[model samples]
Target chain A: MTEAVLAADDHALLKTQLSSALRRQKLSAFLLVAPLLIFVTATFIYPIAGMLERSTYSPEFALEMPRTAAALAPWDGTDVPGDEVFEALALDFKDSKTRQATGRLANLVNVELPGARGLIMKIGRGVDRLQPPYREALVALDNDWSKPEIWQALYGLSKAYTSRFYIAALDLKINRQGEITTQPEDKRIFLPLFLRTFWIGALVTLCCLLFGFPVAYWLSVLPMRYANLLMILVLLPFWTSLLVRTTAWIVLLQNQGVINSLLVWTGAISDSNRLSLIFNSVGTIIAMTHILLPFMILPLYSVMKTVPFSYMRAARSLGANQYTAFIRVYLPQTKPGVAAGCLLVFILSLGYYITPALVGGESGTLISNMIAYQVQKSLNWGLAAALSSLLLVGVLLLYWAYNRLAKVDGFKLG
Target chain B: MSLPVYARPWERLWYYSLRAFCIIVLLFLVMPVLVIIPLSFNAEPYFTFTEGMLKLDPAAFSLRWYRDVLENGMVNQDLPVASWAWLSDVWQNSQWVHSAKNSFSIAIGATLLSTLLGTLAALGLSQEAMPARRFIIALLISPIIVPVIVTSASMFFLFAKLGLTNNYLGIVVAHTVFGAPFVVITVTAAMAGFDRSLIRAGQMLGAGPLVIFLKIIMPLILPGVISGALFAFGTSFDEVVAVIFLADYEQRTIPRQMWAGIREQISPAILAVASILVCFSILLLMVMEVLRRRAERIRGVTPA
Candidate 1:
């Protein structure tokens, strides 16, 4: 009995020792990963989250007009606030003028209610001259103050956090009755831009697939020596500078460029009848297709390399024609690569800025270019953040779908 | 690839047509890039072949564009003296030279930081005991997959808040994040075919973990690490969007200069820069190819 108890004790000790070893190994693994994980979090993920937070975190009015903001806080947002709110706003505007912050406040309010910037700024310059029937004086200052929508917008802006930017991002606005509705037809821009971005992205992806599949097939079927040499043809451009490639496309596709010159010299068209290719949708589509073609071809080639040629031969022997053998027997095996390539191309094209900004004229400008314009030119950071957050979510969803469906981890670059 | 003896004429025609179609596609891929080389040498400031160029006249070609690359942004271009003073003036005063310096410094910084962190993480990730490997890998690689505009916008807002806008450190950090994924991918690929038993053998010979790593594992994976570093360098070199959002005049890079040049005017000087960059890319591509082959040989992947 003592020996049996001792044996059990030994077994227990062994189990504990083994678990401790396992724990040690796991700890070491985590320790190895900790530096990169922390670095990525600090540099990449945190900044993105902070930026997305801006979509809901507009406190400009609250910061600039503290008294008015405090006064409107407890007031229900059903209708316009009472005279006290107007008195607070008038006082705040006077202070804001002295501080030279009225422009900022006007800009903030203008985002929610268009034409409010001019009215607010006009009233701000003359606000100190008004006598103390504050409501009547403020309303008289700008008849726009009579609209309950302005008050509702002010109340919404008074909050530390609001979804106003997101609403605007969707090209919608809140009515005087606090109902969500589409922006007036003249102001609606984002939805159409989004549609155009996706449409261009889809076309580019389609073009890449059409061009890449045959090249990938040829590469995969060739002898290794010849195939390796040919692979460089694909990869050289893949590794080339993006600006170089875009510039090359410009040199090739412009009005006085190579393609037009060649066509004219060959009597395909007159010099006066040269094609308008660059600075339009055609240029964007063409350049993007060229740029993204290698992405499609590399993945397709890798997948095709794994598919044995005998499958098509067997189909042929079973009385299938060449096209049937290709479509039925060969193409299905390459679905993963096709899915991966298309998703990669589509996602990349959606966010393309440089090519579009360079080649895509006003008619072809994408949503990304619009976001860039807002960030840099318009200084509408809140709206930019809202738009970016939507794009981020869309990209992540597609990435998740790609991970689930195409297993992009298996993808390799040559 | 081999036509069967029983093949019909239509089948033969289809096969030959497919081959022809592929050749056209390949030409499409290569022609644009090749056209730029000759255009960069054009005496005339034109994008197309001049009559003299088409006729192969010597007068049609000139090194004028290449000279413009050096002289365009120089402070004292007409300084007739071709001495060290002239060289120093170009180095210190030329805009392109300054941008090139900025690009190199940033690319080097980003590549070093990314390679170190990514290599360590790849080592961890390849281990069986690592927790949440898939989730971790996805997180690391998300920077690469995320749209650059979104990333740039986010970084812009955050950097503006942090006083990091127009800051070199901010751009460096941003580039490091962008570069880390390539390091992870290449290092992990190298580790995939690694023989753990070699490590064990070293340990059995009384070598410490560090010693084993240095003696056995490092040599096996150095090729991958080098290739990854090159990729990281290329990424930083080619990047412009982040520079647009984060950089000021002081941090203007090669791509940023190119962007401004393209936007303002398409000069032959820009073509010269493009040609130089193409040559650089070719060098990098060759190096990567050589390293890849060496790695395959080391891993015994050849079908000998």
Candidate 2:
């Protein structure tokens, strides 16, 4: 102590320096990751936020027809607007026609008022002849122009931010009373499509498990040389192009294709009755199951590889048969693997786009295909965004569950 | 595992049946990929095996489809071999060739980007002093977890607004988001068993951080980074969803062209492309296997 005793203030200052060093290390580590975080925000996260905004904040009509919107804004919406509002609408329609913005305005209105697209386009087409005394003249062009309901629908479209697209996504409608209600029986497509999607996902997951279990067990129990060779089979499929596999399935499942050809040649089935396989649920299930089978096997094999062989032998010595040892003794230990594989396959099948789009025709199409239809064919980006957002929620929830079970640091891709 | 001589007839039956079941399952996994290779050589423009093909007649196989890939868009395909004009025409206008060029360029660009960003983040996350490690890792990996359609559609909207759509750069950036997760996962996995004492040793030996990284750490993690790069390449190469949503006709990639071929008509030309892609994937698979084995040998001193 007499040689080099530090003062009390100096000791406190050293402690402060040590803690500051630790904090500096933490800060440096965080800074290393910051570039990627910032990059992802700009490229990915911001876009997703923008699309969600599109679902509710579409201003196609309100932005294009301001005068009409303002005139309609004061009405109670219980009845059609008077001539003053109609004059504003007629003039706005004329301006929108000249600006080439009527198509968008009509498309927005058509989302709320079904079968109104042709009427609005027709009105826009003939807007040059649309004279004043506008209410009677507009109503004379089409009875629907005078109906309080159509006007009320158009009034809803007048707003910049609305929830109508989301309502339509749920297969619901907004009536003249401005209340949420179910779509008529024939119009309810999405809810049923979503249920079918989940149903198909479960089916595919079950199929993967059925095929994957024995194969995974075989790979796990075998010696390393043999196990590694067999694993290549699984990995090859995992690495193959999705379109290639889908094309292969098409070649195998088409009526003039391999399986049917072989079946007919072997006299197992008549040429007149070649199986209807490629363009239906059967093709989708079979193709998806084959494509996803390796996903199930890889995880199961990884888990089973760690299980000691002695446990099954002990179960056998304790008066259990091979089947009982496997069912009771072995499988219980592989629960996490089972859960992981099922959840992974199910999650994948739910959001599957290529296989289903290629092989799943009509009744076989899932919710993903419907979203594609909205984007490409129907040109309903608002409804498409809404549906995708819902799908995102479901997938995210399942993903969170999978993380809890697998506890994988990050997902391993083949 | 081989069957033990328990001397039970039922157990013998069970063992044989299980083996048979597993063989069929393995066949299911491997056959679809192999099935196309032979079909691609069909002399007839048919997907199914003709009688001659089944009999392995020499005349039943042709390279017409492969020839088609090169000749489909060439202005003067009949020009003599080794002609520069014909070659340039093929390079510029051949549907499959042009798409292939675009595919490789996009894949390479995306792979480089994702590998750089993902490896850095993975390294930072591995640091003992890293804060909120789990949450940051989850956020980075969410790109993989999210559905491709949602990602594609979302990016389409934003990129449209920013004037980033219909260009190779936009596609590259979108694909990097998809590709980054693979790089991050593989690199993080490789670093999980990394020894920290080596870093201290390097420092004590009077080495700088950059020197130690390049001379020591890079060697150990190169295989991981390489495998991750391959994964990223494959992810971008195999992707068609983003292409469908984001790219115009001018920026078509292989998968985009393939999608059109499938939808417009089922063509043997597609089979040719599929055959090429399958072989490419096999090469990729072999490289990955090599990297995995290298990693194993490197980690011999560590816990499995």
Candidate 3:
């Protein structure tokens, strides 16, 4: 009985020791990854989070119009703000004018309510010249001061954190009655731009697949030496400068370019009737398809290499025709490659900026170009953040789907 | 595949048509890039073929465009080409040269940083004891999947707030984030094929972990690490969006310079630069191919 008890004690001790060892191993493993995780978190993840936060966090109005925001906080949304709110606005405008921030304040308010910028600027310029009873003075300064919608816009935007920017991003706004509605037809843009971006991306992916499939098959079937030699043709462009390739397309596709010149020489078309191909959607599509075609071919080639010729031969012997044999035995085997290649091309084309910016004229410009315009030209950072967040969510969803369908860890660069 | 000597004319037609289609696709892939090389050597500052070029005249091709690349941004272009002043001017004040310097520095910095961190993380990930492996891998690779414009905008805001905008460190860090995914992918692949028994054998011979890794594992995975570094370098070299947001004029890179050139002007000088870059890419491609073959031979998949 004593011997049995000792053996049980020994077993328990061994279990504890093994468990401790495992814990140590896990700790060491985690320690190895900690540096990169922390670096990526700080440099990448944190920045993105801060950018997303900007969509809802605008402090310009609240900081410059603190008294007005405070005074209007208690006023319900049902009607125009009273005298105290106007007095607070007058005080804020006086301060902002002296600080030279009134213009910025006006721009901030204008983002939420069009035509309010001029009123704010006028009030800012005349705030000091006005006497007491500042409410009537402000109303006299602009008839817009009497409108409830303008006040509502100011009140909605006065908060340090508001969804005004997100609503604007969707091309919708909350009106005087606090109802969410679409912008007028002329002003609605983001939704269509998003759709156009996706459409262009899909078209580019399709073009790449059409061009890449036969080449990949040819490479896979060729002997090793010739296959390796032909692989360089794909990889050369893959490693070439993107701007260079785009420039090459411009050189080749311009009206006075090599292609048009060749066509004219061949009597296929008159020189006066040369096609206008560059600086449009056609140019964007052609250049992007060329650039991304290698991405499709590489994945497909790698996958196709693993498929044996015997399977097709077996299918053919079983009385299937060439097309039927290929469809039944060959196509299904290349599905993962197709999924990976298409997803990669589609996602990349969706985010393309340089090529589109260079070649995409007014009709071809994508949502990314608009986001860039908002950041650089419009200085509408809030809207840019909202658009970017939407894009991020879409990309993440696709990435998750890709992870499920094709393990990203299995991806090979070659 | 060779055409089967089938007893049908249709099969023969289909086989020939397929071959024709593949040849056309291959030509489509290679023609656009190859066409630029000859055009860059044109004597005239034109994108299209000049009459002299079409006639194959001796005066058609000149090194004038190549000279323009050297002279375009020199502070003292009037100085004689062989003079020390001219060399220094080109080194210090030539826009393309300055951008090339910036590109190399940033690419090297980013490559070293990403390769170090990513290789370490990959080593940890290859171990069975690693926790939350898939989630961590996903996070590490997210930078490559996220739209670069989004990443640039976010980095702009963060860097602006931190006063890191217009700073080299900011660009380097952004590039490291971008390049780390390639390193992780490459190193992880190398480690996946690793023979764990070799590591155990070294340990059983009474070697310390550091000695075993340096002597046994490092050499085995060096090709993967080098390829990853090349990828990281290429990514940093080619990147421009982040530079647009985070870099000041002083921090301009090759792609940024090219972007401005393409947007503002189309010159043969740009083509000259493009030709040089194409040559550089070819060199890199050859190096990578040779390394890949060497790696295969080392792994005993091919005869040495």
Q: Candidate 3 on A1-414: residue-level lDDT in tens?
A: 999999999999999999999999999999989999999999999999999899989887788889998998888876778898988888888888899998888888777777778887898778889877987887788877887888888888778898877888898977667799999989899989999899999999999999898889889988877898889999999888888888889889988888998899899998789998888999899999999999999989989998998899999999998999999999999999899889988888888898999888776788899899999887889999999999889989888887887787787787
Query: Which regions of candidate 2 deviate over 4 angstroms?
Result: A1-11, A74-76, A125-131, B80-88, B301-304
Per-candidate Cα lDDT values, in order, are: 0.88, 0.89, 0.89
**How do the residues B1-304 of candidate 1 rate in per-residue lDDT, one tens digit apiece?**
6677898999889878988988898888877877798889999999888999989999999999887777666777778545887788878888889999999999999999999999999999889899888888889988988999999888888788889989889999999999999999888888888899988888889999999888898999899899889989999999999999999989999999999999998898888899899899989999998997898788777732
Better of 2 and 3 by DockQ: 3
Clashing pairs in 2: none
Q: Write the per-residue lDDT of candidate 1 for residues A24-113, one digit (tens) a residue.
A: 999999999999999999878988998888888977889899999999988877766899989999999888989989888888888767
Candidate 3 structure quality by residue, lDDT tens digits, B196-222? 999999999999999999999999998
Model 2, chain B: what is the TM-score?
0.96
Query: Can you list the residue pairs that collide in candidate 3?
Result: none
Backbone clashes per model, in order? 0, 0, 0
Write down the TM-score of every candidate. 0.96, 0.96, 0.97
> lDDT tens digits, residues A178-247, model 2?
6789998898999999999999999999999999999999989888878888889999989999999999
Ranked by DockQ, top first:
1, 3, 2
Off by over 4 Å in 3: A1-7, A74-79, A114-116
lDDT of 3 at B205: 96
Would you give me the overall lDDT of model 3? 0.89
